[model samples]
Target: MHIELSRNSSVKLYLQIAKTLADRIQSGLLPQGTKLPSVRHLSSLLSVSPVTVSKAYAELESIHLVVCTQGKGCYVAEPSVSLHREEALDLSWQMSLIDYLPRAQLWRNFNHSRQVPYSFHIAAVQPELLPTREIINDTRRLSSEDPDAMAVYGTFEGDVELREVCAVHLSERGIRTEAEHLLVTSGAQQGIDLVARTFVGPGDVVYMEAPTYTGAIDVFTSRGAKVVMIPMDEQGMRMDILTRLRDTHPPKLIYTIPTFHNPTGITLTTVRRMQLLDLAQSYHCLIVEDDPFSDLYYKTKPPLPIKAHDLSGHVIYIKSFSKTVAPGCRIACVVATGSVLDRLVAAKSTTDLGSPLLTQKALLPFIRHRLDNHLVSLRDQMQDRLTTALHTLQRFAPAEVTWQAPEGGLNIWIKLPPAVDIAELGRLADREGISFLPGGVCYAGGMESNHIRISFSYTAKDTLEAGLRKLCRLLGELLDRSVIMERRPIL
Candidate 1:
């Protein structure tokens, strides 16, 4: 019987109180013919005027939602004869509509197989490099010394100091952005969601890099937009196809991860970057550049982000501190050049007032004290693991199993022989002690059956070797079974 009322809401106070009680009755929490509290008692409990409670009860009785007798206190009605079956049917239909509105696809089939022990998730954030001790100390300091900052709701555009620090970091990467152009969000996922909600809508054409980040695909597709998949090669998205497509079907937005792309682990070439910018400028399509792994370069020098070449104010750049700093901290920023920033701000304001201010404040110390040095250390450590993983994979894998060594990034894209089925192989690997992402999840139309993405980021040297060996063994078994099945006479 807890009724929390908001004084600021547009709904009348009495109606709000009535609705709360009606909801309890409808939900069966208040059984049929249950006695409700007296007006004075409810008023005192809710800290509201008795007149308001009296009006609410009168309205409920008038609607036959509750019955009031001469002597007995107001009791929940056992559905009066006036209530129609069609009304209940209509309510059920409305509830079904809300339930099936295609919200965030938070649950997936892969999560159900957690019963298998030794499950290695290739798409997880690397935990070994997370700044745990530093973040814990900063959290303690912020909670104790700056209690007011944590207690109050943050600004719609997030903390100004954090935006200033993010602006400086972007400047170093050749993206000329200011604090005003930046908007902090819960994570890069929320940043992408805000961008999608603000710009594209139903029937809008949104161009996505083929085999792009599955999470982005889910967000855009769930919004009822027509997702047009642009093909990608080793250097990244095929610009020629995109240019032709842009000429024919103008897209509302072009989403890409130009630097150290996920799954493929390929950086976009300078020529393609310039072409993309030109296409975006010529056609009126917005470009969303998701650059989360740009700072984790191992062998080659990091290339400038797509934002650096954007002479026009069409590209929206997004970056996350989750991968570089700590995932639990969940801090990300989006920089849009023109009116896109305003729309994103409005959408974000409605979603949440702002990201956690204390988390933003804690990150200031990392940017000031030891961000560069931490990246350097991480690079060195990852380089060692990458080299070891490459050598071990090469030694254990069969000749038919081919992969390219990415100059930088956390994972490797492996192309198995045509006859092998990676989806089935993933299940078989799950039964064993190893796991990897099937390539079908990355593609748009459920293609690419013989490909897999293997991450060597959080995996230790011994585990990396052991996992590769186990995977190769499974591949061999699959190939042998395929050969045997092919050789057998057809029934």
Candidate 2:
């Protein structure tokens, strides 16, 4: 009954435990109907929290390897029953037969059900925050003036006028690029996917910020690229470690969320932005700069993007309008030069022909005329919300917990005591109609289980304080439980 768990491994603790037990069961070492250790007993034996053991057992049950009774311990399922269950699902065989899917650890956990009244999980701008009237008027005008233009197919590269607008948009961000160099995408997500598809290949080396956007992790891994995570500090992704890792594993690309980073909400300093571009150029690799929150700044604007300083075309810049303008439009653009831009256009053509012409046209007027004023108002509102969230957290959060107040971005990253089990906290929070993003999914491989990300956006203003208070209470309760567990003598 010896089970080993490695804290340093990229795979999660629960998943590792479940996989080991599953292997044992499949190999006939753990026979069918064999009663497994109780959750508490196994937790003590493995030096882990009961919640971790519970999650492992639950995973085992999900794949039909084990079963648990209300009061009894988990037991391995019968071979025949397991076989029948596997046979019931057609795609189950495909998983073993072909290596087609990526290890999407993030989506498996944070599915964004939105079933809860107090959801701090979603990272998009709420409808009330968007310029709905302005966009509607623009759409109406486009329909009235040129009905046939909206109906016809746009070039796979994107609408020329929309590209022109995006070029102007990039110029404001300090990136100098023309319409010909821009590739309009369905969204920033699609832009990331296109980059992955074009440049990444099996076993190729890709580097990223340790806790980056979840979608980037999924996309690169799906392309069979080995993702090496570089840790970050207050300033942003650690440059020294990246320098060290580059000697042994020179990357094909470095994916970054430089400004107002996702999950953590930390911005890379101007010095590091230049350093990053330099490193990418030295390594002869490309940098995919994802800038989703640069415009939503609370204080002074963030430094110019990494792409802005790229004199050698080492950076591919992606800007999304989903958060700032209209989410339903799903509009974003990629700025690249030479062959890289050509390959991205080729990838986009294969993916969806092109992003919808109507949406692009509908958004063009807004981006041209109203985007600046809209962002100013949006930033003001977001800053107010951030203030309220921070005050609530400071008042109710446990003394042991620590978090850095982000200057801008939708999320607030909170670090709890290591002893507090995140699995149990999530279960409790979900039961209480609360949802937040677990920190595990943000990493490329290794995980930090004691951290959680809560977005200040997309929650109703009235319930925001209550949700923060409830979450803080839960953290306190878990810490107390961990103390009690530590004091108990081993039987």
Candidate 3:
């Protein structure tokens, strides 16, 4: 129902109104048979005359985009196109096909084809920051040493040597685990999907932080699990609210990104980490701790993952190297204990037999020898980019615009005034060769449109600064126009 109209435009008012409604209808934003607001209601909403609204509705009816009922309001019309003889096969039966998996908004946003000159939507370290040559050398060594072994299928649980190396790597973060307790996954996303497949089911309750990782949301929802979002503050997911929600809808699992959380870039405090584990243990629910950005901290290390304190085998820790290292390699591991670990292995076997052994072996040498220095270099470079982003935002952004300075993580979440039209701002940004993540797509329940997430680690510092400046200028223009519209006299 949120619509933007320009009174100063050359387009006719009624035609503009019809076009907006037509766009929404065609895009499935306004589904078929949806009842539109009454002419009076829409007129009041748009601050236009009822006659203008009527003309818009009539325009839509003439084009067969909407069907008017005798007493009821206008409704979106179903497709009435006549099929040509060459393509006359009736495929309408496919319309009734089951949609076990609803739309994944994040995937749609990320996979968009429009190439922007300055993109901040990707949440990964810059390619230049990754250890490329060393990885290539490692792959070459592995292929040369054992081409036959690399070509063969690995054990369902994954390469023992890679898992062993990962175990040692995790020990530095205070998570005590052996190679046998880990299950190698294609990536952190695969780890999440495996866990959801192994446990979550239709109508099962899954708790998540609002504005959490979009991939996690899609994974859980695909399993038909009821994803309930817990609101977050600077400290992370509000524990008090979580406790209350658990009493009402006991969850099968709780998903969290404790360190350098995606979208928001907030880390959960140590106390909360322990508190979350305790609640999970008490409630007899498992916690899926996704830790992709934990190693990318700007200064001090983040609190040890919830798995560190998980004495009762309640935490399933997923560690990803895709973002920090070469994303093309796509190597990550899932750490769980007992039955949970067994189930994940079983599920992974059915998923892909095992992750590509070649990639795992290719990444092994880098992890054993060069990982620490590589991470340190990445942290420093990301920190510099973060500083540049903050400086540019301060210099160009309006006073009304605000954001929290995250200590770590690739993204900075910015809040715009509620009155400003984010869709319009996005359109303008796209035209200016800029792109960012709109906040509404991050949520599971309450759709928030006044916030946006931009990554500092993707673009070069100078390009990042320039893109952010352009974004801020476009936002300022939208804000100014919104004020003018609000003060415009009622027609």
For all candidates, what are the clash counts?
Answer: 0, 2, 0
Flag regions of model 2 displaced more than 4 Å.
1-99, 109-113, 489-491
Predict model 3's lDDT versus the native.
0.85
How much is the lDDT of residue 164 in candidate 2?
96
Q: Estimate each model's TM-score.
A: 0.78, 0.83, 0.83
Note the residue pairs that clash in candidate 1: none
- Give the Cα-based TM-score of candidate 2 against the true structure: 0.83
* Cα TM-score of candidate 3: 0.83
Superposed model 1: Cα runs more than 4 Å off: 1-106, 109-120
Which ten-residue region of model 3 has the weakest summed lDDT?
Answer: 78-87
lDDT of 2 by residue, 1-491 (tens): 65556686688899877866764564355657667878887788789999999999999899788998898778888645555555566433232232244455555545656468888888877678888888898889889998976779989989999899889888988998899999999999999999999999977899999888887887886776778999999999999999998988888999999999998999999999888888898889999999999998998989998888888888999999988888889999999998999999998998999988999999998898888888899999888889999999999998999999999889999898888888789999998899988887787644455789899888867788889999999998998888999999999
Ranking 1 against 2 by TM-score, winner? 2
How far residue 81's Cα lies from its native spot in candidate 1, in Å, is: 42
- In lDDT terms, which candidate is top? 3
Query: Residue 26 CA error for candidate 2 (Å)?
Result: 19
**Model 1: per-residue Cα lDDT at residue 487:** 100
